[model samples]
Target chain A: MNGLKQHYAKIIVWAILLTIPYWFTYIGGYLGLANEIVIYALAAMALNFLLGFTGVLSFGHAAFFGLGAYGTALTIKFLVPSTLVGLAVGVLTATVAGMVIGALIIKRRGVYFAMATIAFGQLFFFIANRWNSVTGGDDGVGNWHRMPINLGFTTIPLFHNSLVYYYFTLLLFALAVGAMGLLLDGPFGRSLMAIRENERRARFLGINIELHVWISFVISTAICGLAGGMLALLDNFVNPRDLRFDLSGVLVVMAVMGGMRSFWGPLLGAAIFQWLREVLSSHTPNWQTYIGIVFVLVVLFFRRGILGFKLSTVKS
Target chain B: MAQLLLFDISNGLITGAFYALMALGLSMILNLSGVINFAHGGFLTLGAYFAYVLQQKIGFFGALLIAPMITALLGLLVERVLIRPLYGRDPLYSLLLTFGLAFILVDGVRIIWGPGSPPYQVPEWLTSPLSSTYFFLTGYRVFMVVLVVTAVAALFYVLNYTKLGLRIRAGTKDLETLSTLGVNTRILRNLNFGLGIYLAGLAGALAAGFLGLSPALGTALLMPSFVAIIIGGLGSLLGTLLGGLLIGVAVGLTTVFYPAASEAVIYVMLGLVLVLRPRGLLGEEGRLH
Candidate 1:
């Protein structure tokens, strides 16, 4: 019974996600929005890997995200037409940048780290915004779309069919989430939790704090980059705004809203955020105020997060 | 060629002065409160907007004098209501709260002022160049520099000479000791937050004279200020002032030789600073935590 109870949340979450495409539109959402929620959820969850588990506060995850986005978008647009190639290029771009940046700033902890990340993220934004001839600049990369996957056995018609693309994204999300779960259950994840709880004590225990943080930062950036690539694919477009600081803030809010401590919390938070954005943006031009209010309310009242709150109640 | 170099360098210095004003306020709040105050830019935008509204009522001089005080009052209320509870908690919560506050302030400005850049007028006399020989040096530019220099001098005076300043410095170094010594650390923090916002508000009012009043004005300056703080070193005010000016001049120099890389140059300096001297030029070591 105890074992089953632990897995219950996972089962229910997967069940809903697996069937979301079918039922989402009945509730006035479309397949594209479902795709967005999942993509953003992947990015938020990636951020939570560092934020929730590792105890690092990065206010600039958007740099790697945009890197991944531009890498994939540019690869497909300028280098290769293959979807898989674009993704691989995108992930590689973000991973390498992450390694260098993480190495440079891993020693700085807390708000200083956050400040550095924000500044660094803007560096990329400036590049993307100014490199107009190549990046399409403020206009962004249009006139390009995600190509279909050319599997040896059969080509997946991702470009033509929205339903097929949704499943493809879901499959990738599941793989990333699964890998993250396995990592968390290992000794490496334990080390991160220790660092989050008490850095001094963890250092005293001789856990090699900087290496762990640097690795965690790199992994988080790689995942965020993948999400950015997917976002470009989703819109068949990419812009400097995709990697802007505002998106970084939104990702952090999603993590906090869903319960950063819980693995699935960001996905839920992503759904809520996406739904709110869709609904509120249509109703009024001042929707940013409402989103801002949500951030304040969550910070004030729901810091435990929706999932975290439920878990606490269950424990009690 | 020499003339062009001088022109760009001076241009950079002027921009640097603006960045220094903004970064000094941001650095003070970060050092004392451990809150990043992402809404510093929002406060700046609010300050500019406030001056715009007040300018019609009492003219530019009165508007300039009064707007920052109003912005600082708002800052105090924000510290009391939204930020106070998160003091002992992880700095993350306060950071996020301010991040959200920034969004609200920007959007609110948009809703109230409309989404366009409103025409902002400085006194016509101030807009004119001080001399045709030095055509780039407008009276307003010179006036802004003088105001910033005075503000910095005043800030240093308060920090060095006043009771509140002493407490703020002591608190930044060791908050627990200050509080235990019956200093009322809470009031100290609130006042410090106001003082920081007051600078941001003042910068906005001064900037509006040349940059014009736009919702995005604050956001544009926000990044450079962060770079200034980082380059100046994390906990040192004098360093932030120096960092701001250095970057401003760097950008100005870049514009002369390579205009495309002008904005990118400051970031390169930031990266170099982080790699070579992570504590910043004057930042104390072991302040990383």
Candidate 2:
């Protein structure tokens, strides 16, 4: 019966997601907004890969996410205008950055590790903010947008159509989520869990702690990069704020709010947060105060998240 | 040319002292309680603003003494109410909590003061140049240095000689042992947290005299202090001091050559330290990890 319930739950979630745009339109949710929610959800989930599953706190994931956006934007603007190629560049840049930064901070643990990541993240922001000619400086990297996907004989124009773009973003989200699911269920994923549970025990069991953590960090950052690329494509613009520490903090909050210990937690957190932001910002000018209060409340009270709450209650 | 160089270097040292002062507070909190105090900057902004408020009533000298005490009192309240509950949880909780508190304090200050740089008056006695040739050597600059030195020295004296200081030092090394020895670890952490905030408050007041008072002032100083803590090693106050000074000078020197890279240089220094010495210059192995 429990197995049956779990299977039904997955199907329900998929059904809702697959038709999320339609439901949004049904309930007065904007199509463009729905698309944004999907994009941010993907990013938040990528952050959770390191935080929830791996038991690591990375306050610097925005650096990679923003790198992906810039890489894709720069590639499309200066090199090829192909959407696929732009995404490839974005992923490549973010993954490479992740590997280099991972090497530097992988040895440190806890708050020290978080601090190093923030410093490096800020370093990247400084570069982007200063390089006026190439990066457009504080004006941000714009004037380039996502191109049509060429399938040799056929093409899909995802340039400006909201519905088409939402589907395309969802497609990417599905692929990334599926891949994460596979990883979390595999031996390598289990090793991350081991590290998360107890570093000493994992090290004693012959797990190369540094190597495993490096890979996890790279994978998480790479996927975050992919989400960033998708985000740039969706908005047809990329700015430095995308890579700023505040965004990173939001991602962390999203993961924790959704329940870091469980899969799908970050996605839900993203949904609620995005929705709340939309509602509150429209209603009040002190939206930041409201959002900050929410973060505090989540930390103080709702660390288990909605999904976690459900699972625990059912078990009890 | 030499005089200019001396001026810039001296300016750098002064900036470094402020960084050391700010970072030292952050380091103290981290070393003792394992909380990063993301709101350290917020506390700093408040301290500056508190001085501004008190200056209207008590004047500069009295404000300097009272404002930090108020900030310290707030710190104690926050530690007792918010932080104490999370002592047994992951360090991440405290980090995020302080992060939320940072947002609250920053926005709260903005709401109360309006988001702008408010000109603050240093005492008239401290503004005159010490030498005609070195116009940059204002009495205020010297006073700021002397005040910082005195504060840091007093801090060290307390840490070395006082019963509370010894307990904090020992607790940083081993809370479990300290607790077992019949010491109230909770009070120890609470007092230590207050002490750190007092330093942050002091740094804020000193900083306002130079940078001017603004809601954004703390935000600018916060990251460099983190870099200082990281470069000096997370667990070592002396290392934090050295790291702050080193980066300040590096940033100062960079301004002479590559103006654009001044902010970026500290990050580069951080990366180099991470690569070459992950434990930091004074960080003990396996202490923070």
Candidate 3:
């Protein structure tokens, strides 16, 4: 009877998780901002892979997200007719870029590694801003068509409505989360956790510490890229501001608020952040002050994060 | 080629003056307390903003006096409140705490001042051009260089001769030992933090006319300061001075020659330094942590 009850509870949790995006759309239909929240939530989840699992604090993950968005924008403008191909290109580009940077930076640990990543990320921002012909510079890349998935026989239009795109994003997010879950449960995932816990011990135990970190970095960047591509399609435009370090700071704040150690933390954090941003910005221009204050309070008081708190309580 | 080299060297020295001021504060704090004080940049920004506000309300001289004082008080409050609890904890906790404080301070400035750059003109008395056979320099720039040099000299003297300096040096070398020797190490740490913050504020106030006060300026200066700290060798005041000069000149010359690679120049320098001397130019071995 207990086993049956456990199975039912798991099923219910899964059901709720699956229905979240749909619920977002339902809420958006009433409130008129659900689609935006979904996109931000997706980006936040990508950040979760690096911050939550690997204990790597990135201040510039937005660079990968921006690269993905730009990749998609370029693909739509020059190469691919299908949105699917564009997204694939974006993810692939981000993954390769992530791997290259990870290889170089993973040699350093702690604050040095964090600063190095930030420098590289800012370098990308500089390129994005200065390369006017290719990137559209500060004016942003616009005039792109809504992404359509070509099935060869029938073309499924994605940008006809925000609700449809939200569902498509929901499906993609679910797939990404499921893949991450599997990856985290595997031997590689265990290795990453070990490295995070004690790098010297893990190295002594015959783990290739750098390689594990590099792989995690690539996977995290690819996820961010996927979200970036989706965001470009959703917004119908991509700007240099989308790739700025300040946005990356916001992502870090969100990841922390949601609970850096939890799988769904980034998503929950992003949703709450987005909602707060919308509500607060509507009321005052100084919403960032409030956000900063909240961040300080959280850092001061909630060392374990929101989800971490829940887990500790449950364990106790 | 000789002229270019001279220009680079001169530019570097000027830039180094600013960096030395910034890095000295950072080194002092790091030595006295194990915290990196990420809010160093924020305090610098505060100093700049205070000066700008004072200049608007009173004159440049009055603003100069008031800004640094206000900044020092803010520094004391920060040490007393946010930094006190993290003393015995992991260094990472202190780092994160300061980072939080930095975010609040930066955003707070943005909230109060808005996102735009505030106007800060050089005082009329100091705005004239000063010509020399070697180079025609701006009077304001020359004044800035002189001010920085004098301040650094005075600081060196204080650190060398004063009783407070003796306590700071002893406390930095062995805090627990000093406490056992009857020194109030906690009080020393707080005073050291306050002093470091004051220097940062003073630097900011001085930089206001040169760099102009902007919300984004703190971040732009942050990396260079970190580079200076790293290169100068952790906890070595003289080393920071040399490191700042090296980076300033290297960056200035690189920008003049290959603007495209200018941004990467500092990181490249850091990489080379790490490879050749991971302990930094003047840093003692095993002091990296």
Position B161, candidate 1: lDDT: 100
Q: What's the true lDDT of residue B188 in model 3?
A: 85
TM-scores of chain A in all candidate models:
0.96, 0.94, 0.89
Of 1 and 2, the candidate ahead on lDDT is: 1
The order of the candidates by TM-score, greatest first, is: 1, 2, 3
Ranking by lDDT: 1, 2, 3
Q: Write the per-residue lDDT of candidate 2 for residues A257-280, one digit (tens) a residue.
A: 888877777888898999899998
> Could you report the DockQ of all the candidates, in the order they appear?
0.56, 0.49, 0.31
Q: Please give the C-alpha DockQ score of model 2.
A: 0.49
lDDT of 1 by residue, B1-289 (tens): 8878988998899889888988999999999988898999999999999999999999989999999999999999999999998887777788889989999999999999998988777999998988888887888888988998999999999999999899999998999999999999999999999999999999999888877888888888899999999999999999999999999999999999988788889999998998899999999887876
lDDT of residue A87 for candidate 2: 94
Q: Per-residue lDDT for A209 in model 3?
A: 83
| Candidate 1 residue B8 C-alpha distance from true site, Å | 2.5
Which regions of candidate 2 fall more than 4 Å away from where they truly are?
A1-6, A26-28, A309-316
- Alpha-carbon lDDT of model 2: 0.86
Interface RMSD of 2: 4.9
Predicted complex 1: DockQ: 0.56
By DockQ rank, best first, the candidates go: 1, 2, 3
Instruction: Evaluate all candidate structures by whole-model CA lDDT and list the values in order.
Output: 0.90, 0.86, 0.75
